[model samples]
Target: MYRRIRFFLTSVLFLCVATAFCNDKENPDAIIGTWLNATGKGHIQIYKQGNKYFGKLVWLKEPNDEQGNPKVDSKNPNASLKTKPLIGATILRDFVFDDDEWNSGRIYDPQNGKDYKCFLRLKDSKTLLVRGYVGVSLLGRTETWTRIN
Candidate 1:
């Protein structure tokens, strides 16, 4: 009877520990938040739509032109988009979460009027690593983004 009781207690303890361990794992939606870009010039807000993730420039350090007008996507390749405001523009698109990383996305560069293949991974709960590549990942650039909220 004592042996059986000990075994039962041990099993309960093991189950409790296992459950805690599993629950402590990071959620796939943990990336949803406002993040400060590496240059500290812009703030990107990441959000989910359906099952995919996207990020947009929500704020900019220099949100105005020399004439003090609201900044627009002046460098956008599409002539129509060139007049679109940059603050609400979606810069990161179509990212899908997989194996602790977000991939299969495109990152739009308003400064250069270019789009590059991109991927994102969390360095921790508060830090994100973003990579944008042209042809291959090895030829890409990585930027560190910090959570803002």
Candidate 2:
């Protein structure tokens, strides 16, 4: 009877410890890392800030223009922002985890200076599906982003 009681107590303790280690909110940075864009044109480093997530340009395929000058957002719709450099630009913003995925985020495309409603769903530990749309999520396009490291 004493052996049975010891076994039961050990099992309960094990379960409680496991449950605490497997919580989602506790791992807010589960998806924080460097990821490559679909076309292999950019590497974005996702980071967390005050319970929200954002991504910025860390590396670029072509960092310089034809004249060997650092690249700028020349295509930006806003004339004032057109001169802003591309490196370290905040291209993703305001992401929160929800329903086993990260939702309610915005992705900014520097190529066209357009912002799209986007959400991220991890396909696995090494892959992520990023969907961007205008209105409803059903009308969006999904892009596969591979984890950089």
**How do the residues 31-126 of candidate 2 rate in per-residue lDDT, one tens digit apiece?**
799999998989999999999999999899998899998899887788987888898888889999886688899999998889999998887767
Q: Spell out the clash pairs found in candidate 2.
A: none
**Residue pairs in collision within model 1:** none
Evaluate model 1: give its lDDT. Answer: 0.93
Write down the worst ten-residue block by lDDT for model 2: 22-31
Give the candidate number with the greatest TM-score. 1
TM-score, cand. 1 vs. native: 0.84
**TM-scores, all models, native as reference:** 0.84, 0.80
Q: Estimate candidate 1's RMSD in Å.
A: 4.0
Off by over 4 Å in 2: 1-27
Stretches off by above 4 angstroms in model 1 are 1-26
Give the alpha-carbon lDDT of every model.
Answer: 0.93, 0.88
